[model samples]
Target: MAQNNSAFSDSSVHVDVKDYYGKRLQKTADLKTGACIAPAQPLPAFIRDALKKVHPEVTARYYGCGLVVPECLEGCRILDLGSGSGRDCYMLSSLVGEKGHVTGIDMTEAQLELARKYMDYHMKEFGYKEPNVRFVQGYIEALVEAGLEKNSFDIIISNCVVNLSPDKKKVLEEAYSVLKDGGEVYFSDIYCNGRLTEEIKSHKVLWGECLGGALWWKDLLQLAEQVGFSQPRLVTASIPTIDDKELQDLLGDFKFVSATYRLFKVPRGNTKSCKVMYNGGITGAEDVFQFDCHYTFKANEAVEVDGEAASILTHSRFAEDFTFQPPGGSCEPCNKPKVSVLLHTSDCYDCVVLS
Candidate 1:
């Protein structure tokens, strides 16, 4: 049994998690299950080089399930919830550039200490003018106490940590609160196809290993919608296996997947009535782009999308990267023909008719 000796919280779940990350686990090898590890996915060379530069000590303590990196991060402000050992923070430091900043928050002091230990070293190694990444010892479920300002960060990321939070809904709500209007919450965590029983939830070993704490996929979707993030997009998913037979038996028939999802804090509109066209504007995505699991936009191709989807591309950080058209496929004249022509006067052909 893991004893919670941390000063973070009184809840048994929080105590166990703090103990698990702060004491019981020292390295990835100490984990009893493969749940904390992400499935094999080929990494791009730039990302591979960034991972290679991370301190060995940081990698040794990492226990995440997936690569939750999103694009357009050059000058974006990023926050990592439960950023153990600052592994992702350091990686993001190389990507966010000198003008950008990365902040990591964790409840465990031991992890925070290790993360802060190499701050200067990493800053010098990355060739930055000054330190751009900082670590804060705090709870993911409560960000205000950590002195985080609302509507501040451009992007918030968590890797296999949200499942460990005793208050997942609060964690998400806080995430939404701290993010800028066009910002996004891109994260990777464990999810089960079915709900777990009280018995499983109470198991200390299972919870620490991240299996017993998994949220049902559908419930996670519902929770996201409940908190104003009405549209949650799944980026990647893979089934995870438990090598320990004894623990696997306790898991019973529950199927768990390490899934990465991105929820944007944009206006919730019925994207059902919009048409979109990508102008090959975004640097790397000049030809075609996969907006989510359901939508794809080809360069110069006007694709029909719902109002919500249109709002996602136009109102969010991706707005300048693409052009938007209104519903009914009509850039034609209304009561005022000259007004219609004025609205259509652009190389991108943005004809979104104001209702």
Candidate 2:
């Protein structure tokens, strides 16, 4: 669902992307590549059951590359950019509980229409007196103009949609502007190991399928920093399934991966050496809680973490779920947090300190 014209100077690519997602690719199976598939790891029982509650019609049109669901979503305000057919929005609605709200925005009217059609049904199914989810027609690049307010959302999620925007930086900026200080944008999309050629960038089928429009992994990190989000956490990552021989030949060893990255909007702090304790209280993850691919905190155990990790646990929405203890004999907060583990192939884990 990620389509944009900025990768190339041509405007036709943009038109093709709208046309393909709006009318051409009508279902999940309509996608020819592995861009929209689910994760290799099996989802937990609660999440799987919640997904089953999503109307089949909505899931039929889902084109996301990775799982967008993050931990501790209860009672949080969420925004889903490029929320095609409301698949993830509805699932989030259930996770955030009745008090929480979800807003979905997309430029494609046809997809939005399908998402809107099931609102009443979902509200009734969730046993809510009032509906907590709604779909709006708009582009992801201009969220403020689309009626989204500044510093309003606790979490924002997008599914394979950022690649389709020509102004990827603007999209990130708007996302940052709308997020609360502790809010985070956790999205799943396709990223290539290297930059693509102009010919590849302009390929209509490739662009619409999320291949040709993929951002180089390095470029994505740079964009995050430029927009004031440094040291993005790699939540999950996987190699894309490029089964099409013709497409494979066109790619020519340009490795692509489906990665989910989370960027927090809090002040960039030095990595403080600290320890955290998980109380075994979260709904699904009681015995152990996986913060990202790198760290998992077990119940009643004191887990040592770098400054960035400590900030994530002590300052963000997940703060209440953890108890933080800073490094011994040091009142100075960690300014430059560094992670020594390689959570993914070719990933840079330099934790940046904000000014």
TM per model? 0.87, 0.89
Report the poorest 10 consecutive residues by lDDT, candidate 2.
346-355
Query: How many clashing residue pairs are found in candidate 2?
Result: 15
Which candidate has the highest TM-score of all?
Answer: 2
- Candidate 2 C-alpha lDDT tens digits along 1-355: 7886443232565577779998999887888898767572468888888898899999898888888888888899999999989999999999999999999998888899999999998888888899899888777877887888999999999989999887789889999998898898999888887789988888788888898989987888789989998567777677668788888898886877788888887667765768777778787788877666667667777766767767766668888877667666232332322232554324432221000
Query: How many angstroms is residue 109 displaced in model 2 relative to the true structure, after the best TM-score fit?
Result: 0.3
| lDDT values for all models | 0.80, 0.80
Candidate 1 residue lDDT tens string, 1-355: 8885643454888889989999999889999988898652456577778888899999899999988678778899999999999999999999999999999999889999999999988988899989999898888888876888999999999999998877789899999999999899999888876789999989999998888889987788789889999467765666676889999888887777787788989878655556666777554455766565556567777777656667777767888776677766663221211122232112111121111
Against the true structure, candidate 2 reaches a TM-score of 0.89
